[model samples]
Target chain A: MRIGDLAARTGVSVRSLRYYEEQGLLDSSRSPGGHRHYDEEGVDRVAYLQRLYAAGLSSQTILSLLPCLESPSAATSDSAFDRLVEERDKLVTHIAGLTRTLESLDELITLNRKRRAASVADPDSGEPGRTTQG
Target chain B: MRIGDLAARTGVSVRSLRYYEEQGLLDSSRSPGGHRHYDEEGVDRVAYLQRLYAAGLSSQTILSLLPCLESPSAATSDSAFDRLVEERDKLVTHIAGLTRTLESLDELITLNRKRRAASVADPDSGEPGRTTQG
Candidate 1:
């Protein structure tokens, strides 16, 4: 398909598609007229890349892993699969850490808002020089 | 304090501190000896910036929000606080979405691993030619 059609089908901007290609996350062959052409499998590839990215994997990591999915030799090798499992486990742990930190940030934001509201309501009660003094 | 002390105290690398300064997330004044000097409050500021970055906020967003914490006018203004609250809410939503996606990817990886393991164990049973197949 052409770039415009691929962008519309994937719901990704053409610029991002180009960027992904530049990052080696996507590929397109040139036609006889020098225009880009992508096969139907490109859609699935793009979707997989998007999923990896959303999971906080870097473009470089995704590019490296793409070969494991594409090459039958690597896909069928027990050791390769084992390595993939280990990498995925690390990714899960990393995501868990990020999730915990995100929750803490949410709590901090909530507390900050509450403190600000209280300070606004009671100018002289909480923390001298912090109410009308700051 | 100098950059090295600040890095030692914060547990951040000196290179990252310099990068943060280049990204406008940190500031340092020069001493008479041509060395960078930071006030005590710089520690808290760096910590805050780290927290924001860990929360998945971009350096640019953190830099923009830094002024709110530093300037009494913006910090105390109800409108500015409201904007901050809104931005924080958006950030929370974004983090939640990413967390959900991460969880889904974890499940997908688990399923893939299980399928691969079963295929490896039974070379002739599952899915014609898929056992010993690619």
Candidate 2:
């Protein structure tokens, strides 16, 4: 597939795909006519890259991790797998914190919506005054 | 408290605190001695900024969200709060996805560790030969 197909499949922009290639996070083969072509595995690889980026991993870090992901044997040596485990643990903790914060934000939104509905219905004299509604 | 103190309290580097100030995500008053002074609220604000960054939000996005957090009234107008609520929802979804990936990585690490231990104990044979452990 071409870059456009990869972009469409991965939901990443063409510019970002090119940038990822430049950053060594992705690679494509050159055709005889100078066109770039990606294999079927490219879709999964791009998806993984997107997940890593969304998880706040820098492109350089993702690039380094990609080789380990592709070859587990290479990853297991020299405690590389250990480092990956540690990084994943930290990511899990961070995700949990974000989840809690998100829940609090959702509760705040629900409360705010209820208050808005109450104010709209009454239009006056509810809680203190309209000046301090928020 | 000074910027350095806020940095220490929030676990954010002083340079990043200044960068956050430049990005308008943080605000501090200047004393007569030309030093920046932050209130107790600054610690919480900086902590929130660090979390937002870790959650993959850009400094600009955090900056826009900060004003809404500081003044809920201003946030309520034109559905500004609604946008924040939606963004938070997306963040929650992203965090959940990351959590799942992290768990999968943990399982992979555990399996790899067990396989390694078995390989080391026997130095051969286990699961259809040791040619493919990973």
Candidate 3:
């Protein structure tokens, strides 16, 4: 498919696709008319790239780690696999932290809802203030 | 506390704290001697800002949403709180996707470890290829 098709399929802008190619995070072949063409694999590859970027991994780190993600069974050294495991551990820690944040948000939202309800029930009670959570 | 102290307390770089202030995602007061001073509230504020950044929220979006996060019970219009809930919902979706990726990585790691153990047991089984998982 052409660049436009890839962009439409992935929901990424054409400029970002080109930037990914330039950063070596993606690849394309030129057509007979010199337009960029991406194969079917490009779809999943772009999706993976987007996930890593969303996780706050730099393009450089993602580029370095792509091999571990792309090839699961090609004979890599134990140390290489170890590094990938380390990266995974980092992700685990990150996920845990985000989970905590989500919980905090949930608590705050619940408290606000209750307060809002009370205020609605009794308009003369003065405005309910922000919940002070440490 | 001073900028450096805040950086130390929050584990964020002093430069990044300055950047956050410049982006309007954080605020600091200046002492009479012209040095930036941050209050106790700045600690949690910086931590929250960092988490938002890690979750891929741009500074602009975070700046706009700060009020919702900072004040849970202050009388915000229904629309304002609705926008915050929308953002939280987005984070929930992102967390779900990352969980899937983490699971995928776990499977790949397990497969690779099994393959490595098998190769160790029999050096002449011909190279085991990647597990073809769709």
Across B8-48, the per-residue lDDT of candidate 1 in tens digits comes to 88888889889899998788999998888998877876776
lDDT by residue for model 3 (B1-134), tens:
99999999999999999999899888889999989999898898888788777766788877666555666554655766776677778889988878877787787788777767777787755445643221
Q: List the residue pairs that clash in candidate 1.
A: none
True contacts kept of 3: 0.30
lDDT of 2 by residue, B1-134 (tens): 99888888888899998998888778889999989999987887777667677666788776656534554432255456666776787886887778767865665566666666666767744343222112
TM-score for chain B of all predictions: 0.64, 0.78, 0.87
Best-to-worst lDDT order? 3, 2, 1
Better of 2 and 3 by DockQ: 3
Give the backbone clash total of model 3: 0
Q: Candidate 1: where are CA atoms >4 Å away?
A: A18-24, A27-44, A67-75, A78-83, A119-134, B19-45, B67-75, B78-80, B124-134
lDDT of each: 0.64, 0.69, 0.76
User: Candidate 1: lDDT of A59?
Assistant: 79
TM-score against native, each model: 0.68, 0.77, 0.83
Query: What are the chain A TM-scores of the candidates, in order?
Result: 0.65, 0.81, 0.87
Q: Compared with the true structure, what per-residue lDDT tens digits does model 2 show for residues A5-116?
A: 9989989999998998899877899999987799988888788777777777788766555534655442246455666676787787787878766765665566556656
Q: Ranking by DockQ, best first?
A: 3, 2, 1
**Stronger candidate by lDDT (1 vs 3):** 3
Residue A38, model 3: Cα distance from true site in angstroms: 3.7
Residue B77 of model 1, lDDT score: 50
